[model samples]
Target: MSFPDNTVLQSFPATLNHRNATIFTANRTDSSAQQAIEDLIDARLQLRDRVSAPLKGMENDLFAKSQPLDSLRPKLRVTFGRAKRDGAFDWPVEEVINTLGAQKRGAPVAGLYGFGYRKSALGLIQEFFIFTEMLDGHLNGLTWLKRERNIQNLIHVSFNLLHALHSKDIVHMDFWANNVMIDPQQPTRAKAIDLENCFLTPTDHLTEVLAFQFGFYYRREIFRFVIEHDYDRLVFEELGKYDGIDRRRFDEIYALSKHENISRRARREIFHKGTVVTG
Candidate 1:
């Protein structure tokens, strides 16, 4: 799926209508997929009541959203609903590309189309929607890495993507292989998706304040790799070579698991220095 060479929209419209629901797009100048977006919304509303688990619901919703529509562009993807505990609907791809200046950094995120929301009879927000360019012939990183002939290239690109994000002070809390997309045709090409959990911070560590505030679990290995600015451990992990990890670093981060009340500043200091630090 290819898009014509047109200037990407820099701002979202105040509002647009699609039946009872309102619509928004990443590019206001691009007038397409309005009916498809509304159809996605309708399908999601119908499935919302039947699904219970958040992740499971999203899996089902992806299928629902993929229903073919004549107006839907072949390159477009419409995602509905927010992750559990998300306070508001945020267009992370728009923020990363537009606000953070990641467009030039080779930050592998899908091109945003826009988002929309529907309000209930009482004027309360009911459903949320997101639209982005589809990554055709791409598989999740986990599955792709297993069969990829040149695994090194994918691993290297993954590290580069992470470095680009970290340079902008953005920590992608869910940097797991499942969140990465790899194109088989272009083996080295990788893209990061599922950006709702990402956050910007100056420190290299996942501080206690930020973790609890965002309901993020303290992932020691992720924190270790982020602080060290290295991807060797991740390469091993992704390749299913758990025994290949650096035991010293693993044990060091593991030691902090039992200390629940450590202060945010202390946790940050501990991560940087690899030593117990008290606030």
Candidate 2:
């Protein structure tokens, strides 16, 4: 199927599951949108042939036979399949569409290149494909940061992204260290990924949505530590043992995260100020 005019293709290598659907990336000579779709179909065919006669325990290894694709620019290709029972894609198609919307709206996210789907003999949708920019040379926030400056920079970047999303009334339901990726070359800039679970709501619901996310998400412990002591102690006294981020500024982050009105102007202030570390 021909994709929209905005579609562009590059190459990357990765294999992972999206719900029950299989997603993988491969290289292709053609950069056009239609050619990209055909490349994905060819990759799927190759995957099927390999899986048809699996080696011992190979079925259990999802990353088996994964190989890197060659390209000057890297792009991600995701494929989604339908479940037999529900006759629907294993994952929510709207999630991918919403992510594209987020990217277009200036949210810190991977750029969406294009998306298309395959249909069955009866014209029913059988599969879905999405193409996006590959975040090359990026490491998640959980990875090691060799310098105190790098750590401080990541914190600033993360909160700035959070505020950006909140300003659009979008709640990153799974905001955490691993969801934010940074490149050493651009230490202070980060991009958020895994936005499939993000939630959109009215501006008035922003604080409540943020509260819910905090209560149930991975970084709830950060707030707990902050309440018991303070953002400073939580950073310098506790987490400093791990990352050595002591003396690094976090006041703006603390104020934004702990503010009663989380989506208020404070977030805008921090975002507009372009939080950066000095000294």
Candidate 3:
């Protein structure tokens, strides 16, 4: 339970999961790699510091509580966790999300902090966790699903992850950068965390996740987030390169996202029940 130890951490793939992720093995002696990480760390710290500047800039707390993400119902094989420099540690939040009474939440894959889980050790079935540090020589970052062309392969995989989550009726309140994850070297490594505000549907409910027939406005948002961020890269030049689709699907989804009428369709799809998308 000692955080799988350095040997284990090093041996394990840079990442896991099929949603969207890129895990790279650590470098023992790479100065540039170390510097790039330092740069990212600096940027992250700067962003955190900016939180205090809200009045003149923005006034928000730097860190909040970490929450449990999800886990297997029948089997304990799955789990998830959310954390930053610090986490609020809300246990009952899960109850609210799981209560299908106007709210449906995922049971959890589970959330384990690098240090917390290791200390409080939850039963023998759990794996010891350590802070997912952006170590000097080791950097594990989320591949912006629709943000970069080099990681373009993640589009289909991430879409499927989103589909699977929606199928269970879990509403991901925050689906932006910090919420999304990816593995650059491995295929299908996308992840969405920070379930503090998530609403759940039902684990057995196929309607929540993507059914072939269900019309989730997800198709549209995926296009929006993508085009707005990484669409211009040379790799994304053609839509066909994606999981193999015609160019029109791209334009089609993008167009739908701009529709003011039904523009809120995606939001309503996951949030409110009676909310209607005008289009």
Runs of candidate 1 with Cα error greater than 4 angstroms are: 1-10, 28-32, 49-106, 149-154, 204-251, 254-279
Give the Cα-based TM-score of candidate 1 against the true structure.
0.54
lDDT of each: 0.44, 0.44, 0.33
| Candidate closest to the true structure, highest TM-score | 1
Candidate 2 per-residue C-alpha lDDT over 1-279 given as tens digits, one digit per residue, 9 for 90 to 100: 211212322222334333333343443223343343444455653342221111122222211122222221111122223222322212224345456657757877766544444434443434555555556667776573434334445555666666667666566756766677787787566777766556454333333334333323224333432343433442333232223222223434443444333332233222334332211
What is the C-alpha lDDT profile of model 3 across 126-194, one tens digit per residue? 211122322111112233443454434554554454555655656554443334455455435455544
Between 2 and 3, whose lDDT is larger? Answer: 2
The number of residue pairs in model 2 that clash at the backbone is 0
| TM, every model | 0.54, 0.49, 0.34
RMSD of candidate 3 to the truth, in angstroms, is 14.9
From the highest TM-score down, the ranking of the candidates is: 1, 2, 3
Indicate the residue-level lDDT of 41 in model 2: 55
Question: What clash pairs does model 2 have?
Answer: none
